[model samples]
Target: MTPVLYLDFDGVLHPADVRVTASEPKRPRVYNGGSTNHPLLEHAPLLERILAPFADVKIVLSTSWVRVLGYEYTMQQLPAALRERVVGTIWQGELLQHPPRTRYDAIQSDANNRGVTRWLALDDDTEGWPDEQRYALIAPNNFWYGLAQPGVADELSQALALLCAGKPLESRLPQETHVPSTVERIFGLG
Candidate 1:
């Protein structure tokens, strides 16, 4: 099976706190249908750099952008090269009143339905993920910069390398350790 990279956009591609007003008095911006006009869109290349080497890696959108912008437009927002790597999306237009308790549950539901065993989720929210799957997630401690933070992309790449090498989900790499501090573990900064 091809390894899937479950990707989120708001916090993963750019700053989650970036505010957008309906009226922009400052500058004339190229507006897509949705809020893909992030200043950090320039960081697309950084994501590409890490993902490029893993030819077997396929992308699966776990971002809400897919629902708002439409699948085709959301795919266009990504770099042209990465567009082809996109195989599918996690959300399928379901309007659940009470959505899955956490992002991990939603991703796992999709993964389970798709029969995807080899996969890693890159998201900012790390709530409710069990330790087994937590190792597979390369969550950003810094929401503003996401993977652009120093060493984050490298760590993500390394994790992908291990996954692509056929390592089981339960296997822990040398760099990975159980966080002793309660705060770090709770926030998934471990």
Candidate 2:
């Protein structure tokens, strides 16, 4: 089965925001949806419930959540089992230094790592991408420009349905995809 490349957390797994308080300097902040009333965390028991149908599928957490919230902090919030299913993650930290090019590069890298020829990305940002090709431009319920989340959402069934039928981008743009042979280095595939 092909992997489902999930990117948006608010639409695919959680409510988009949760309050988290920390001491020291005394700060109250919001998390990237996963617990309490948040979509994915609220329905933690439903991860398998939702994924059992796609047992052959694999998941790639291509979110900036790891960078913002930190890897350990996010994984600890998972409901044990789902935490194990994740093959890996791609944090768009430095990518943020760039713009649309960064987003495009990260997606391509994630796809390559998973050996994904076909996948879908549930993101609110479709800045430089085309709608006719790969990845879904699914907008989340309450998506923030720079925040990140780590699961599927409750209200994105239609988008997910489209993702189920999604295809990969075949863009000829130099910035959209990077085939190894096209790289300047010659150590291996490049």
lDDT per residue (tens digit) for residues 1-190 in model 2 = 4656555443335444534455422221345544243234454555556555544445566555655565666666666667766665666454444423655567776676657765656655455665555334444434442122333343234334444555333332125566576455676655
Candidate 1 residue lDDT tens string, 4-78: 999987667777654435575222232335455657455778889998878999999888666555677678878
lDDT value, candidate 2, whole model: 0.51
Which one wins on lDDT?
A: 1
**What is the clash tally of candidate 2?**
13
List TM-scores for all candidates, in order. 0.77, 0.54
The lDDT per prediction is 0.76, 0.51
Please list all clashing residue pairs in model 1, or write none if there are none: none
